[model samples]
Target: MKKILKQVTKYEKRISVLLMVLSLALIFNFCINSASAASGDIIYVNGSSGNDSWDGLSAAWTSGTNGPKLSIKNATGTVNSGGTVRIADGNYNGINNTKININKNMAIIGQSQTGTVINGTDSAWIFKIQPGATVTIENLTITNGNAYNGGAIYNAGNLTVSEGRFTDNHAYVAGSAIYNHGTLAVVYSSFLNNDADGGYGDPAYNFAAGAIYNDGNLTVTDSYFSENCAMYGHGAAIHNNGVLIVTGTDFIGNSVYGLGGAIYNDNALLMANSNFIANVAYAAGGAIYNIGTLAVTGSNFMGNVAYGAFYAPYISTAGGAIYNDYGGTYTVDSCQFAGNIPQDIYNNTEASSGYGSGVITGSSDVQGATVKAANKTMPLQKTGMPLIGFISAVLLVLGGSAVSKRR
Candidate 1:
């Protein structure tokens, strides 16, 4: 009987220890799961019939909040899980003066692409993402903004824009449509009729990049830049001072005054399956101006024009497709340059005058050691827009003498 009691006590002790261990394990598991959990809310905004006092919950414009400001403010305050702001199909005006500032990790999505619009009223930017923020915008249109740097959107953090249109914006300095000081990814988007045409009289004023200015990592896929203009600067389409990778993008009808009618690259740039067509530059590089490492693969350049101002200091056309200067190295693989005016591939690195254009490589036509053509053939794409800005300046300079003689 004593041995039986002792055995039963031992079994009870073991069971008690096991139960305590199981309880501890269950508590630890619960704590771990709670610590890793995520929670947030989805907010709504309606522009046409919303009011500022309404709660951002209803999908109908009559009951939802009018603008994006309050919803963004609430989302930034939320902890753990990030927030999402869904906007309805209507024209929206930015709140908090002239711009809608975002300082949190949030997603702004539109109900429809063609029906949802964000208008800046030609006074401010539509969206400004601050540092340490992550934002994603999709299926919307941003238009009619005016600013010094970014007219439509200014990003100082990580930003992703998908399936959107940025049009009819103007900037006085750089990036008429968008300015990025951080990581930016654009997919299936378009930048049209944006102008970076201010800062004329100041000697330091070089109005660069009618569409975008990137000082950080930039990735563009299946995007388009069309009918953009830069008045006294370079890169009517894009100005890149950092790493840029463009795949399946198009640059059409962009114009500039100094160089790079389509793009100006000062750092690492890689373009694959892209198109540059009908771009005009008053000085050089109707397609691209590369001051850094540039690689173009499976791209096409068609009908690009590189002309000089007849009455200005520079009076020659060079590099109707690409003006590679500043000891910049470029590799063009399986790329085609067709019907480019004046010449193709203006290499200024090996100039006889030490500052002018240089020898031809892989082509039959050598125009007096001034312009070179890289013999290549490929197809092209088309975008709707008439060439205006810098080409008009070139024609005015050339035709000015004839008009004066007639007068």
Candidate 2:
């Protein structure tokens, strides 16, 4: 009888331990389920329905208590314009169907572009900014958003960028860092090592605009674009189809397959107190390929090359350094265009197809004070105006600081 009683006691102890383990497992499973359900909620990208979510203190988005916690963690989710999504800081290294669709005013505060990354791989761009939507981005270090156009960001409407570093971003068509069709303004923004290498994609043309392929109005002030490259055609740094204004900026190490290693302007290009250096091109205009009128005041374009079409190297060659094709003209003052090697200075109609117009040593200073320079007007958009400021603020928060916003 004693042996039998001992056996029963042993079995009871084992059963009690099993029951506790099962209870803990059930609790953990419930918690995970709840967290996942919470992350699946939808939000807007940047449009507004006349309602703002950045102001007002609310936690739960629905009841205005505890704002919903955003956790993707290799999971799939959709972002419209509704609430703020906190990336929680980690490598979103998979193709997680994660998107910020333009619907309402939305803000995505990721830790710096280098630390907190959103790899929208397995498809196209990491963040695809849709048309007719206003998007504001800050403190987000976004890269490897591979697409034929707008590798990192493909904007169709109004985009304001501040304090973000678009590095190693690429596009096959145009605007490796940003392919803008509507309007764009970059203030205090740094675009580095973004490539505009056009390949055998749709249309298959030279659309690689190192930093931007602006067909509309583009305004860049107090920005830095360096080591950016383009495949074929104008303005390795900027292939502007409309108006472009540069103020207090730096363009360095920009290259092109054809013309305009530093800049290729088709419509109008204007600059003030800017610097362009160390840019190269395979064809004419190692520093500038202006098919239209290129104007600058208080700017410097030195250490540029204009390798002429001829085989012999002319160290003092001028036009090769600055090529203005199809009757392109320039009015520059207080600017430097030395260290250029051009086949001819201007009107080398015999050098095959390219006809360089402006040289470093000659041409207009102010074809008159007030000319039809590239329209320096930036696209009008409210909420986070002057993209550079917002970019800086976002970088501050993303550099490992925990984000705790009330709205």
Candidate 3:
């Protein structure tokens, strides 16, 4: 009886070990499947040789049922929320009859900025980010879009664009390249040759915002805007009815028929370390037209032109660099304005003021006088040292010697 009892105990121990092993195997299999699901969240889109019916799990074609999707639409639809859609280097066109709607938080990354192109073919807006969505687009060129409002992209959600190029997009009303109704951040991007012109048979129609129309919060850093035109509108490059912050940006060769060759601020605007060169406006404000609050610091404006026209009854030309309209509040700090045609700063406000080393040209009409200095220097921060002092310090650090001043 004792031997039989011991043998039963031994079998019971063996069964317990077997069950433990089986449980561990099942747990390991489940973890593997979970990891795979997480890894498969990223969908691939290859415009050249891809099939839409296949699972967009692989970058290259592996089998008849598993490969990259053909279009961005398919990849976007297949990707999970907060997933990424990787686009190959190819031109993607023929978007659906309606726009490509993105309703979830995701990222769309292109292989290269210049190699991966999304051409609208003058059809419709390419991507429409729906409300409550967050999207990030990187390293892509969005071009040739034609729409009545937003040409390239209509963003109603939070969007971040980096290393993107928006060119040759046209709109009839506003925002040739992008219309922002929510928070938007653009970094290391370029807007070129985008226009907001009047439609056919409407030459006298008034449009707005050649490149971007912002009715929400927008921040632009290290970007370039060039050759954008608002044919009969305000803001050749940007029209801001909300908060706008621009830093380390360049605006060049933008033109408008009405006001603000480069930017029109109807709400609040802040610019720092930016350059406005060769922008033109037929009516007023060659570089910027401010009807709201504007603050400029450490910026340079050169070669901007505000050419007046005799449009039937009146001639209006003012503010080659900036036009502070009546009731506007503005402060220019450590800004340099030079070589602007007609004037540099035209202030029609009651209490607009400038501080620091902000030097206006001889033709500026601010407070019925101009602020000009013979030995004008670049705009430097009040707390920052001069360039010569900085150079000397660098030399001392490098050579461990005192440098003689040559006057």
lDDT (10s digit) by residue, model 2, range 68-133: 333332111334343444444455544442344454444555546566665655245766666655
How would you encode candidate 1's per-residue C-alpha lDDT over 1-407 as one tens digit per residue? 99888656645543453344345435533432332212356667655555446556555544234333333334334322356778778776656324777777777788888888878788878788888777788998888888888888899977889999998888888898998887788899999888886375355867478899888777888998887888767788998887777888888778887778889988767778888877877777878987766767678777777785532422454678887774565656567766676776766644453443222223322233422246555444422223453244345434421111000
lDDT of each: 0.69, 0.55, 0.74
True-structure RMSD, every candidate: 19.1, 27.1, 22.2
User: Which sections of candidate 1 miss by over 4 Å?
Assistant: 1-39, 61-81, 94-98, 310-317, 350-376, 381-407
Poorest 10 consecutive residues by lDDT, candidate 3: 398-407
**Displacement of the residue 184 alpha carbon in candidate 2, Å:** 0.9
Q: Rank the candidates by lDDT, best first.
A: 3, 1, 2
After superposing candidate 3 on the true structure, give the runs of residues whose Cα lies further than 4 Å from its correct spot: 1-40, 96-98, 198-207, 310-317, 349-376, 379-407
Candidate 1 TM-score over all chains jointly: 0.75
At residue 185, candidate 2 shows an lDDT of 65
